[model samples]
Target: MTERQALVVRGGWEGHHPVEATDEFVPHLKEHGYTIRIEDSPAVYADGAYMETVDLIVQCVTMSTIERDELAGLIAAVENGTGLAGWHGGIADSYRSSSDYLHLIGGQFACHPGKAPAERKGEQADNFVPYRVEMLPAAAEHPITQGIGDFDLVTEQYWVLADDYVDVLATTTQAVREWDPWHRPVTSPAIWTRQWGRGRVFVCTPGHDMDVVRDRNVTTIIERGMLWASR
Candidate 1:
């Protein structure tokens, strides 16, 4: 069989360590018969011809901006059967300026609520909380999540604003602590898949750093998601 193509688009916030994070997955892609092409910017999305030849896109960009045409090309590529997959803010929180991009991914990072004032310093790490990622019953049989039981992690638990278009597989719940403003607990999609035209889009929200991404459960889910979403 001809080797499949995978485009790794990585950049944006240094905190996410896009390069190191994406590099860890390169060997996996290669072992699965993919010829990898790595780009440091979302600009590669604008290459319509190259994007068309790609079977999978693994994006690690976080909180970055995308040009109108670049976003358009990405949407077109996925809509035309190219797989799009990412974890954490890489895909879920990327390209905040484009509503169309948000529509394509079907989820956005609202915030990761931190510890109470007295218990925390002013650091991003304050947002790292212990949370359980529960696999939803509806997705228990889904290929990407099958055989994986719910697991716990102490990481940046994201609060996402997602749409109904995504088929949610797993979720994390944020409690209604006294310091928090919300009256009730909030549950966000921890793992989800979106079917866009001929393509598949997958997102997992636990990968805040290398350690989190390396978690056994997270690693397995992401690996499965990449293949499951690929054309």
Candidate 2:
């Protein structure tokens, strides 16, 4: 039997609490029989030899900078066959200043246009809001969403600008109201999958906080996604 290994990198903007979020996910990987190694920074990416052994990479780092060499190794690992999976701003909102990283990931966080007025704080968008996720036709048969159904969530409904290659799994259509400035009903991809070289990438834009991930349906789908993406 072959030993399974996974690398979990966590850091970046403090607002998302990367440490807490990664803490919540590590056990899930462990439960699947993976020997997980956790890193608080991307420096681990500098070791090309070490990265080659990883079967999956679960990155929770939000908006943070990565040194050129470090970024190169991480990209190479994934391109060579290491699976990559993450959710929310951690992956989509990561490395805001790096276009190369964004290109590899296939999507960028555009905006959360439907944030509730009461939840909004200063310039930063609100974290909690009631919403419903609609499953996409293409995702109906996908392993990650097989048993999952449309469900409601109390978190930000990320409106992403995805690349043409992404296989959208689910979407959330924000309701429109007269008082809302953005009247047009907005549809955001809630979950998606993409391929990078010989590797697989899976992303879910719903895990804003631990509570959001605690949703039974959300947990099930994300777990299934991790398994589907793993090599």
Candidate 3:
């Protein structure tokens, strides 16, 4: 079989460590017969020449903006049978102003509420807490979730605004932070798949920290997800 072509568009917020995060998965994808292309900017999304032939795009950009034509190019690429797959803020939280981009992704990061630190300094820090990722029984037979049982992970548990159109495979609840009274027991989609024209969209929101992205459970699911989403 010909090697599958994959483009990893990395760069945005340094906090997410896009370079390190994307690097960790490079070898895994290579083992799965993928020839990877790494781009440090979202500008790669605008390259119709490159996007036209890529089998998969694993975006790792967070809280970044895309040019109007670039965003349109990405949309067109996916709609024209180029698969789009990503995790965390890279694919989901990116491009806040682009509804068309969000429409393609099927979800967006609203918040990541964690338990507040016990000790008080002059200022408070982002709560980094633990949560469990639960895979729905219906996804048991799905390619991405097969043999992937529920597991507990410590990271920034994201509360996302998700669309019903995607095939939800896994989820995490919002009961970690007692501070947020309104968000208790609210289940959010952690892993899901959507269709954009002839292409596929795969999303997972577990990799806030590099450690979380390196977790075998997360990496395994992502490996499978990339193959599943590839054209």
Highest-scoring model, TM-score:
1
- CA-lDDT, candidates in order: 0.94, 0.84, 0.86
User: Per-residue CA lDDT of candidate 2, range 72-152, in tens?
Assistant: 988898889999998888899998888888888888898766455665676544645678988977777889998677899
Model 1 lDDT tens row, 65-165: 99988898899999999999999989999989888999999999999998887889888778888999999997778889999999999989999999999
TM-score of each: 0.98, 0.91, 0.93
Candidate number with the higher TM-score (1 or 3): 1
Screening candidate 2 with a backbone cut-off below 3 angstroms (N, C-alpha, C), the clashing residue pairs are none
Q: What is the RMSD, in Å, between candidate 2 and the native fold over all Cα? A: 2.1
| Model 2 C-alpha lDDT versus the unseen true structure | 0.84
lDDT of 1 at 96: 90
Give me the runs in candidate 2 sitting further than 4 Å from their true place. 114-127, 179-183
Q: Is candidate 1 or candidate 3 better by lDDT?
A: 1
User: What ranges in model 3 sit over 4 Å off?
Assistant: 117-125, 176-178
Residue runs of model 1 more than 4 Å from their true location after superposition = none
Candidate with top lDDT is: 1
